[model samples]
Target chain A: GAGVSQSPSNKVTEKGKDVELRCDPISGHTALYWYRQSLGQGLEFLIYFQGNSAPDKSGLPSDRFSAERTGGSVSTLTIQRTQQEDSAVYLCASSPGLGPITQYFGPGTRLTVL
Target chain B: GESVGLHLPTLSVQEGDNSIINCAYSNSASDYFIWYKQESGKGPQFIIDIRSNMDKRQGQRVTVLLNKTVKHLSLQIAATQPGDSAVYFCAENLHSGGGADGLTFGKGTHLIIQP
Candidate 1:
């Protein structure tokens, strides 16, 4: 079966620029999540979406970060006015709707804010 | 305030030897734990998982041990191979009232296989 997929394997942008990273979850997956990983660090949760209710933005580092999942399938994470600290790999994952289910991850988009 | 952490940043084991990676978690409310492997340029792949009720679980050549009393978790790989070289992470999740939250991941341990 096809796994989760993300676009722009690598991205380089200037500080204060905005970037949009896309994610396509596996078919039939209802729960989607976005995470960030800095070099030599752990995965940091960003946001989560479950069948279109309000997304969980608790983990978003700041108000400049936002995400949207449309039609319960694809998701896009947008970082506005990116800062040097936002440089990291952005990863996307999806699961079968919750409760101890394993999440499938995408290759991720490496964002570099110069 | 709650976080998951690993004791070692790197581990080197000879091929055909066994490898053990340890993790510590601070959230007692976490009921599910998972291990993942991430190779360079790739996202994390799920390795194994165990619930709080179970102390141990086994996969093909891997075993996951959870000690809730000590908030410790370990992943043991038997006969480690070159392909096993990667960053291994331990994650904990709290299931609340049928809603699922994102996992909290440890800093990760880099496993190097020596031939």
Candidate 2:
């Protein structure tokens, strides 16, 4: 079975620029989540999407962070006006449904805001 | 705010030995817990999970124990191997009024296996 997949394994961008990270969840996964991991740090919740319903954006640190999922499948996380603090690995995961279900993750996109 | 924390930042164990990683979580309302393993350069993978209703669950060579009364969780690995060396995280899910709630992750524990 195909696992979750992410685009641009590595991205280097200048400060104040915007970057979009993509994620493709498994074929039948109805729940998708995005998280950020800084070096030597734990994973931080970013956002979650379920089917075609509105995403849970509570974890978005600021208005500069936004994410959207289309057709209940692929998702894109966009960071506006990137700062040095935004440099980290963006991870995407998908689960069969909701709570208690195990999630499968992608390789992640390492975004470096220089 | 509730917090999930690890007792140790790193644990070194010899191959074929049992490994135990401990975690303490706040928020008595939390009903589900999970453990994930992430290797360098890779995203996290689910190792096992335990629900609030149960005290323990086993999967292959891994076992997860949850103590709701104490807000504690533990993951035990049998016959540790070099392939098991990675960062392990414990996460909790609190039951909210709305849809699926977010997961709160604890500081990870780095497992190092010595052959």
After superposition, the stretches of candidate 1 with alpha carbons farther than 4 Å from their true spots are B97-100
DockQ of 1: 0.64
Q: Write candidate 2's Cα lDDT for A5-107 as tens digits.
A: 9999999999999999999999988989898999998889888888856446778889999888899999999999999999999999998887767778899
List the candidate 2 regions with Cα displacement exceeding 4 Å.
B97-100
Cα lDDT tens digits, model 2, B31-102, are 889999999999999899888889999999999999888888999999998999999999988757365456
> Where is the poorest 10-residue window by lDDT in model 1 chain B?
B93-102
- Count of clashing residue pairs in every prediction: 0, 0
Residue-wise lDDT of candidate 1 within A1-114, one digit each (tens)?
Answer: 899999999999999999999999999999888889999999997877887753456788999998888899989999999999999999999999876778889999999999
Instruction: Please give, for residues B62-82, the per-residue lDDT of candidate 1 as tens digits.
Output: 999999899999999999999
Error of 2 at A15 (Å): 0.4
